[model samples]
Target: MSVVWYFDFISPFAWLQWPHIKALAEERPVTLRPVLLAGVLDRVGQKGPAEIPAKREFIYRHVLWRARQAGYPLHFPPRHPFNPLAALRLCIAAGSGVPATEAIFDWIWGQGREGDTIEALAPVATGLGIAEPAAAVADPAVKAQLKANFEAAMAEGVFGVPTLSIDGRLFWGSDAHDFALACLRDPDLWEEAEMHRVAHLPVGASRL
Candidate 1:
């Protein structure tokens, strides 16, 4: 069975999880699914961590720390909270695979490049061997695919990037990387009758 990694380039946490998940791909099939984090946040009526003040502060610092710990260079984009629509669309155009996705993430987070617009991203795209990135990003099919991915993610109960889905269960956030790997290693971990029951339970059932 393949594990699905739902991601958005705008998220530093997603960037952090990329290497780990890529390594996991060696052991199991991993599908990289690009979805818009903004759309997910809008649908779930949630806010990005960087949108909140205290969390934003911590995120800036922690992301850098985490990057160092992981041995990856981390640099926040020059502008915070910039639109990621164009970049996301470009990812769709680039096949949404590890190479393209890693290039996109590196351009924004690793190189500290600004990526809010097609104009700003064109050079990065060129460097990544994606010919005509601007035009490809605007292609109708690419646009639709990104939207479809977002909706599909929502339908699958995905509320955040760096989310891993295996056996129909979602493990969210970069912190869940190890747990997801464990689940992949042992599919039987969620094979019990109670696990199946939990999967089908109504939302907020315990609260109700």
Candidate 2:
């Protein structure tokens, strides 16, 4: 089965996870599905880590530590929680291939560039051989494709960026990459007693 990666450019974790997911392309088919993280969060009725004051500060520090530990170069853009609609649509316009996808991630996360506006992302598009970045991303079909991707992600129960779906199982977050890889190597691991127990664990209480 193919690995479907649901992500949004607004997430640094998605950027951090890009290389590992790209590596998987060498072994099997990998599809890059760009969707709006904001839309997903709204649908789930949850605040993003960055949307919470204390968690925002902690998450920034946490990701920095994780980047240092992983030896991945990371620089936050001028801002966090910027609009990523243009960038997401750009991915659809650019065919969502490895090169284009990596370049978009690198432009924002690696180079610490702004991706909220079409003008800010024009260079990335031009470099990728798309002369008219704004026009390309504004295409009706491109916008429609991004919407479709988001709808499909919702249908698949994806609630976060950088979620990996394989063989009907979802592994969310960059930290879960190893576990996803292990499951990929051994699909039957889900059959373990602990796995079954956790799957049906009873909730003692609920905040809702």
- Quick one: best lDDT, which candidate? 2
TM-scores, all candidates, are: 0.89, 0.97
Tell me the deviation in Å of residue 117 in model 2: 0.5
Give the per-residue lDDT of model 1 (tens digit) for 1-208. 7578899888899889888888887777788888888889899989988889999999889988988988998888998877998888888788887778888888999899998998999987887777888789889999999888887798899988879998668999998888887777788877678978887887764532
* Candidate lDDT (C-alpha), each: 0.86, 0.91
Candidate 2: residue 3 lDDT (0-100): 86
Candidate 1 residue spans exceeding 4 A from truth: 191-208
Clash number by candidate, in order: 0, 0
| Clashing residue pairs for model 1 | none
Q: Which whole-number lDDT from 0 to 100 does residue 38 have in model 1?
A: 84
Clashing residue pairs, backbone N/CA/C < 3 A, model 2: none
lDDT of 2 at 105: 94
